[model samples]
Target: MSDLTRRAVIGASATGLAATVVAVGPPATAAPAPAAAVQPVTRGAALYRRGRFAKRRTRAFWVAGPGVRLSMKLVAVTDLSSGGARGSLRSFELTFRARRRGPEQGTYTVSRSQFAATSLFLVPTDASRRTYRAVVNNR
Candidate 1:
């Protein structure tokens, strides 16, 4: 073959080889496995010191606002009886730390009956800042 033709053929072959190498490169590594699910906190019925019942699951919902976030802990749930019927009631305490406001803590009582739940919020103003009570009723 002529020198010019041979040089052109070699240049084309080198370009093809480089393209093949790039096309056959190893794939990227697989993504990592997802994190495990967190287990829910369960306080047995015995802690209520009330009537007998099965184990109940207590869950907290963290609410985030403009400049503050509240961590509410489901501390206790008690069954209140009025008349001959029983109702499910829940007591939750909220501890809040504000970015530009004062730190505050409060207790809320929530009650659920049939399909409705209500919460009453209370704050302490005296030395009794330790414990606060709320009464929630089902509608």
Candidate 2:
């Protein structure tokens, strides 16, 4: 081939080989998640901040079931914090009042409009069987 034609062919072949290598190369490492992309706390004491539930006292939360949704009122919030700091909560209890009876004692999906659904283990507290309580103990 002519010198100019030979150089052009070599350049084209190099470009083609680089493209093929990239197309068949190993997967690239993913960039780390941004600060704003922080994941939601699914389980733990961190998920149960006393302020979130205390401020919503008297509001309603829905208890999700297999085929039904039960409305329960957040009747009270008792701060059982370990008193380690001014506002730090180590433990707390949430009391909910349901109009009708629900499952005796088990983990059910509890949801509120202000936040995502969360699983909570509720137990009937009173003989009337209308009040339910869930304790989130971090201490």
Candidate 3:
């Protein structure tokens, strides 16, 4: 944020009024956000579902956060394009669950193929919950 816009937001917040600033061009003032309205969040937010998940060519993802106690599992794995005509692969799609009491992490290790891909699906259990995607790099 720029100086002018930051000042405006602060000023409006002090007066208990909503303020909006255009992130594209020069700063412009608008009304403040609603008391119970949902707002869009940017990357690297401290949310538990997706703290700082980013897609990569090598790794599926490396994400971690604190949502009190949490559980993790390899829900699904799909190989859309494979050079080999037919073959069995390795995966713990089910019957794999790890629980953490404090900070937790969701990651993977790809040893057989050079690359693997999956979507980090998330359901909004609460108003702050969200979905995320990850990438794993072994090269």
TM-score, one value per model: 0.26, 0.59, 0.18
lDDT of 3 by residue, 1-139 (tens): 6467888888878665322333355667988878545323323213212111212222323222322224344333322132322222321111122232212234322111232322222322223233222222111
lDDT of 1 by residue, 20-44 (tens): 9899897889776554322223244
Model 3: residues with Cα > 4 Å off, grouped in runs: 1-64, 78-132
Clashes of each: 0, 0, 14
> Listing every candidate in turn, what is its Cα RMSD in Å to the true structure after a full C-alpha superposition?
14.4, 10.9, 17.4
- Of the two candidates 2 and 3, the one with more favorable lDDT, higher being better, is 2
Off by over 4 Å in 2: 1-41, 81-88
lDDT of each: 0.38, 0.76, 0.30
Best by TM-score: 2
lDDT of 3 at 16: 58
Q: Cα deviation in Å at residue 7, candidate 3?
A: 46
State candidate 1's TM-score: 0.26
Report the lDDT tens digits of candidate 2 across residue range 37-131. 54333575545788878778999999865454789998988864344344446567789999997666667778888676777778889887689
**Decoy 2 TM-score against native:** 0.59
